[model samples]
Target: MKHYIYLFTLVCIMMSCKKPYNPPVTTTNYNYLVIEGLINTGQDSTIYKLSRTVPIGSAIANSPESGATVTIENDKSNVYALKEIRKGIYAAGLNLDTTHKYRLRVKTTDGKEYLSDFVQAKDSPTIDSVQYEYTGNAENIYSYTHDPKNNTRYYRWEYQETYLYYSPVPSYYIFKNNSIVPTNADDETQVCYISDTSSTILLNSTAKLVQDVIYKNPITVVPITLDKLKVRYSILVKQYALTADAYNYYQNLKKDTENLGSIFDAQPSAAATNIHCISNPGVPVLGYIAAGSVSQERIFIDRSDFYAASVGVDYSYCGGAVITYKATQRTPYPDIITIGTDIPTDSLVAAPILGSKDSLFTIQYATAACVDCTLKGSNKKPAFWK
Candidate 1:
């Protein structure tokens, strides 16, 4: 009888297990509305990307918005119609207006309309003058300084430089009163033509304007022609608080360890340190200082010929670790041979060394900065000294 009872209990447990368990029902509803391709500023014609949201836990199998009319209109009468450049990439053909706010409106083929909240494009700050200083050291480093007066600001620069080159050609020199200066007429009367026409010269060179671009953003846009050369670059620079904690964090970074470790390595050198390595190399080590906090700030330039020859991968940004190099080419100036002690300005201009516009020396810009460090007590130590 006990065996029969155990069999019945087992049958009852099996029956309970046969009933299927149900999962909790989720009530989350998803909508298809996403805004992309938002530019930093609205001053120029920028693309405003729109897309539908993929359902959660759903596989995306060739999901594309077949037919959609996307329009971006500002409070003003600036209506921008978007063209489908590629799949899901709707380009708005209107330049940004700083004066008015803008909104994105989308209409689907199924009579469903979607609208986005008005978002103002951030304004770009004014760009100050760009100054380049060349170095005489063998490393051929150039230092560029962008001295923007504004302190509380974040900015990036895109350099578009037009390099000019001219070749020599012979032509007749017609003098005043329709008198032609004969060729090989005299040492001073020979007719020669200085070529003034300039053509775009493509530099066949590669430079590492940025290295280990894990930190610096890479540009994805198709190489756009600025002037007459292909261009590439993408960078992100933000403003951070200048504080001890922030400085400490940077100091502890592997890239910044060398400079930080040198803080406590200060010692009196037998000679003066070459503070201006660009101008004076192998100068003496004036003194050394202890490590202290330093605020690091920088800007990112693009990867172009303007950067390839002069800037290196580690020196692309305006701040941080920098190694400079010299220009590979030198300028040629003409020297004049004359009898007079004082050469006339008119005659001097005809000589190669005197009238040459090109400089034998060119500077290559690299990124580097000085951090505050502690120094040893000196014989003329002031009250601030311990």
Candidate 2:
């Protein structure tokens, strides 16, 4: 009887036990800013991105101060004030020139302050020349090569362009292998690069004869008297940024490049345009035409406008790359030759035509000759033959 009573008492004690304490859940907030753009107005402009630094432990985004003020300036008198484009993107009117040093300062909408050390922009190097040649397995494409004879000089390019055409759809056709291709042919603008190596060396050379020879007998096109292209070159400035900062800067520049897709971005088309006239007095011949048997006087017409820009910094400097600009032609260039020079006098004498803005193209150091830089001599190599 006593044992039974003890068991019943133990059961009551077990049922009366309590659970552990629990705490209330809490939440935090954090925010971060991302900047992705470039200063390519051809003049001076500074792009400054702003955002609140996000915290690691917070799930909520921080509310950035809306009335923030940012400023960028160079050692010279040039100064630019940042204007808010979006919630976190701030822009300034400071023009971009590589000859000066720049510093960035920010004042948040709530009066918070941020600053960046002085960043020096590098001067533009001379371009030897801008030249192109046939490339690829079938030699169906043309490319640019750079050839600054002086090893100490460097260069980059940016194009201002306009695509001129007229139609209900603003498109046109270019002949390829005896076939007509309909493309957007719309007026637009953007920045592009020379991604091939062979094209790079060719781009840097200043030899006009080399360019003439290549254009006379293009790798892809039918080498006829009418097959000519107009090409021009200009001096461009090279900039420097730290290695870690380059990737971020490139992404931003690309974003701005994507915005140049408007119909009004190119020049207006005229019913009558100037073609090469035979034997004009007082005018120097720019190019030669390839006829059935004999070469004649004809101006070369560039179907695509090209540009190149270089970017680098002093500390642990990295080489630059090339960018190209064109309308709606998306053909690949397998083998390219680029010829360029930094000398202002040797550069082509043309400015960005108003109402006819060509897209910008950039070329930096990364555009080197191919590991196997072989020219297709009469062997009819697949890469050099059409």
Candidate 3:
């Protein structure tokens, strides 16, 4: 017993001696410029995102690199300027000729110049389809595409998903000017649309196959519990063609930026980039500029396909919250507190009101966010929504 007790005491001392090591990577502020996105040779707009690498333990999730001048230049010296669509996001479609090689040039606000190696434009095959299969618990989405010429061997995909969902209960009336007003069709706050984009790097290769065909490339998985699958949902899959070298860059990038949950996980290192900082050659830039025409396909899934599997978002809290009790809400004064902002969700008529008259009743109200679908998402439907 004494030996076991001694061993336990020693183990505790050894465990207490363990300390966390904050590596130089975390302590150092190495904000390297990260250039992302493609240079489209098609009618679709070419978008590029510029951001700086944030050190570990940053409160902000992203650090966008703004005020940078980005442009695409051809071997013939034709330069097409890109406009900043948003902070750190630059986009513009180029009248690109497939015969000519292209490159990107960037001038940061700091007056530093970066240029990418000239790359030939890649032609992407049209996406055959975007399909989804629902297993009671989840929905698995896939992308299908093929290049008959066998010229396009490498591939990458991105997706944008939009869905229609509704509030737990439909609000028939709206609170306006401290009065309950009957809601019109335009003012209905029951259904709404929400959108999300792909965050993961999706890639596939058919280099060694007899035909350059991709089958059921896993795009994303949707949990039925999310509001996403509550009603009608649509996914637009965008496919890009990648060269052999560009494919390697994306693969390395996916590894360096992800899967760091523990100290034993792979530490991030600079991924190879075609972009070179001419001002300071020693400085590291992360990204490769690929010139390609995008292929797209969209598919919609209605709840009827798998309605029984969905449990949807629970908004019962919006109903159980009783802000106050009232009597004769018609008075709209001191008998009951005036609903300054929202419509009363429920009203009791000819029921005894607490601390008020017997003939009067109670009105239960909830915050606008709880009852108004527009608060969470746009009530105005998308043009393509069916």
User: Candidates' lDDT values, in order?
Assistant: 0.32, 0.32, 0.82
Ordered list by TM-score, greatest first: 3, 1, 2
Runs in model 2 with CA error above 4 Å?
1-31, 36-43, 49-67, 73-80, 83-100, 110-112, 127-386
Q: Which candidate comes out best when scored by TM-score? A: 3
Model 3 regions lying over 4 Å from their true place: 1-29, 172-188, 262-267, 307-309, 325-343, 346-361, 367-369
Give the residue spans of candidate 1 off by over 4 A.
1-31, 39-44, 126-386
Please, what is the TM-score per model?
0.28, 0.28, 0.82
Candidate 1, lDDT over the whole model = 0.32
Cα lDDT of model 3 by residue, 1-386, tens digit: 99999999999999999998855655577888889888888888889999988877788779998999999999999999999989999998775788889999999988789999999999799999888988778889998888889999999999999999787756666666666666788887788898889999998999989999999899999988888888888998999999999998888888876766776878877667899999999988888989979998888988788756336777666763444334343464332235544555655334565675544544566667676777778888899888
TM-score of 3: 0.82
Please write out the lDDT profile of model 2 over residues 273-321, one tens digit for every residue: 1112223322211111100010111112233443213211122222333
Candidate 2, run of 10 with poorest lDDT: 287-296
Clashing pairs in 3: none
Compute the lDDT for candidate 3. Answer: 0.82
Clashes of each: 28, 94, 0
State, as a TM-score between 0 and 1, how close model 2 is to the true structure: 0.28
